[model samples]
Target: MARHHTVRALLVGGPMYDSLYDRLPAFERATGLHVDVVDRLPHPELNARVKREFESGAADFDLISTHTKYAPSQATWLSPLDAELGAEIDDFLPQPRELSRIDGALLQVPRYLDVRLLYYRRDLLGGSSVTVPRTWDALIEAATTLTRPGIYGFLFPGRDSGLFGTFYELLVSAGGHLFDANLRPAFDDAAGVWAADRLAELHDRRGLTPRELPAWHYDEVSASFRRGEAAMVCDWPGSHHLYKARATCDVADRVGLALLPSGPAGIRAAYSGCHSFAIPRTARNRAGAVELLRDLTSTAAQLGEARRGAIPVRASALAQIRAEAAADPAEAHRWELLTRTQEAMIIPPRFAAYPECEDAIWHAVQRAMTGVVSPQAAVREGAQHIVALLARERLSPQPNTV
Candidate 1:
């Protein structure tokens, strides 16, 4: 039997900060292990710190948790888990696990998955003429119809890479490709232009908000919804729980969640990503570290995590989401909406040039949203920047199709 010991683990994430505080007691009581969590640093900062640890031979953590998006380039620093984890992985959803793999090697063990979802004030639209939109055109029309002074029709985060990435997901769902399999820029097409134009319309023509809307991140926009400042927003599952809290929600029963409107392909679409756990190569207790990961992702651990509304990595834990809902009607409906969004989720391709590409896209989208240039012009400029960066790296663009 594998011996359990005191495993020191470092978790790097934001959503489950409070959940961990409440849930870890049981874990420690059962295993006699103490977990340490480091919150607040962004992904880039954490990556830099990990690199420094390896360079200086000063290891500080045995296990690390991060977003699944970093797997492709960060694989070198991750310990291979296939030999240690065994067959328990068959319980996780297929797409998340597939994305966690690097060259057929398992790089991380996923825990919870997050995808984009639409949140709106049902009180404002519920009894009124407004209806929750299911297509891009319908959404635009609703935004125009429901918008008024002091209240915006639609709002989405557009700040920095978060905003740009969300918009790019819409472009992909709209039948656009960032690059071909050959690593060549393929975003300068009608689908790409349409995506940009749609966003610009929300800002300029639809009266959603001025250029200031894009500056808002997920938190800001979600707060606006809770405060009844925005009529519609595209957000994640966290907002559902955040709004349900008695102290935060102004319209607790009035919040309605739905899938993002379908795109040109008539498909419900959302940008899906996973927050996962990985063992670092510099760990002093490799075997113990792997056990920690297994413990965290096991059916029991995952079920506990899902009890607090986290989308667990393992499929068996999904049943917990339903059971919890059965006990709480509000939670049941919210989770049902989350499950719908999950079905529509698509994981973005991870590449070495992901950060650079994200930067270029952010800048380009900002210029277009501000009316400094047309959508076509902005996308053209963004594509050029991406091409230049790729050429410098002696690589080409390789966009993944969902």
Candidate 2:
């Protein structure tokens, strides 16, 4: 694994990733692999840079940050890590341990993870008779009990990717799957119908959530929890720093994090992915790239990442994090919440058409949420739309950009 060449890296911003960003020089000194970090851009620019530079046939960086869902679509331009991986990957959390491959080629190593979790108002729940719901049925009971004059019980994503992920997770937790082994849509059956019914039930609840959830902005989804407008919410760990800030969040000290409530099938929800390190196939420093990835995603690195609010990718890092956060109850709760969520994780479908598929599915979920149609009816028609869309896509395959 020893390498002398410098590894040109382009990483994105995350509290945990900051450790790497701050200590690139030390990494080079210790490993003999100098890293020239390119501009540490915001997520959108970073993603665009990876695509644009690689597609332009200019391999400027050796190690580029990647994600599980969308990165698979660009796998052709990335080098496969199959030959380089070994027992080193054994201890990572399942969902974040491996990157999605476009066509059976492993193109990246997972670095850190993010998962959907429930954030509830601890102060409100303590006064009520309800405990955190462990199942969908229980959630309804809890939400109903919590709803009073000024506050709502639960909140979900109103628009954007959050809506899609939440809908997909509910579907999966209720024993429904979007695609079968044949890469064909498989969500039109009874399981799918049952899942939608559960979702619609929540949407139809009178005082349990926002009356005009569809009209609520996406940012308001999390803000509602912090401002005490909603008693419970489903959001990512990256937003934790903000939600727990005393100056910003009214419920800061009273915030409690929990795993997504269990569903009809008894499994909790986990719609998740990771930021990873990938080597472009056109890179001149293959050895250096692999060396850099190994060092960056090491167990120690993950532990350091967790201390700053980034969820770690490795299983062992969980215990390390709990120990480190022993003095901070809230941070310890985060680590515990993370472990529980990771156990419930099951990766979403990994295919190039997923973005379009997600949009199609979100539309149906929105229809149910807005009360235009019943969950059964929304899914029945949603499944039909997905199948038709996939069929059309197959007829005239869209070209890949990167």
In the range 117-194, model 1's lDDT, one tens digit per residue, is: 777788766554888888887888888888787778888876665677666776877888777776667777888888
Whole-model Cα lDDT per candidate? 0.71, 0.72
Score residue 238 of candidate 1 by CA lDDT.
40
lDDT of 2: 0.72
Query: Candidate 2: TM-score?
Result: 0.74
lDDT of 2 at 275: 74
Candidate 1 clashing pairs? 91-315, 183-396, 183-397
How far does residue 220 in candidate 2 sit from its true spot (Å)? Answer: 4.8
Candidate 1 stretches with Cα past 4 Å from truth are 1-10, 15-17, 25-34, 42-59, 204-207, 210-212, 323-336, 392-402
lDDT of 1: 0.71
Give the Cα error of residue 187 in candidate 1, in Å.
1.8
